[model samples]
Target: MSPESLRGWVKRDRIDRGEGGPGELTSAEREELTRLRRQNAEQRKTIEILKKAAAFFARDSDR
Candidate 1:
């Protein structure tokens, strides 16, 4: 099975065992994930700004 499929099976098995299951992210893991998500949001905002700037320059050239 593919890695994705394997991961899914593992998650399902964990849930079946009545463990924390998919909610098992530790304090450190959760903090890191939150930081990464925030960083990704910032990167997305930067990309959006760059796209708008590029479009504005392109429109100016077409004038």
Candidate 2:
């Protein structure tokens, strides 16, 4: 089975066992996740900007 499938099964099994049923993340954990997500978004935006700059530079070089 794919890793995604395995992760889904594990999540399902936890819910079935009633062990906090996937458990709500702690405030700290939630904040950490949010911070990480924001960082990831920022990184992606930076990468897109860099890619555009590179493409522009490459076109200029070809001229």
lDDT of each: 0.82, 0.80
Worst 10 residues of 2 by lDDT: 19-28
Sequence-dependent TM-score of model 1: 0.61
User: lDDT per residue, candidate 2, 1-63, as tens digits?
Assistant: 899999977765655556443565544566899999999999999999999999999999998
Runs in model 1 deviating more than 4 A are 1-22
lDDT of 1 by residue, 20-56 (tens): 5456765556689999999999999999999999999
Q: Which pairs of residues have clashing backbones in candidate 1?
A: none
Instruction: Kindly give the stretch of ten consecutive residues in candidate 1 with the minimal lDDT sum.
Output: 14-23
**Best candidate (score: lDDT):** 1
TM-score for each prediction? 0.61, 0.64
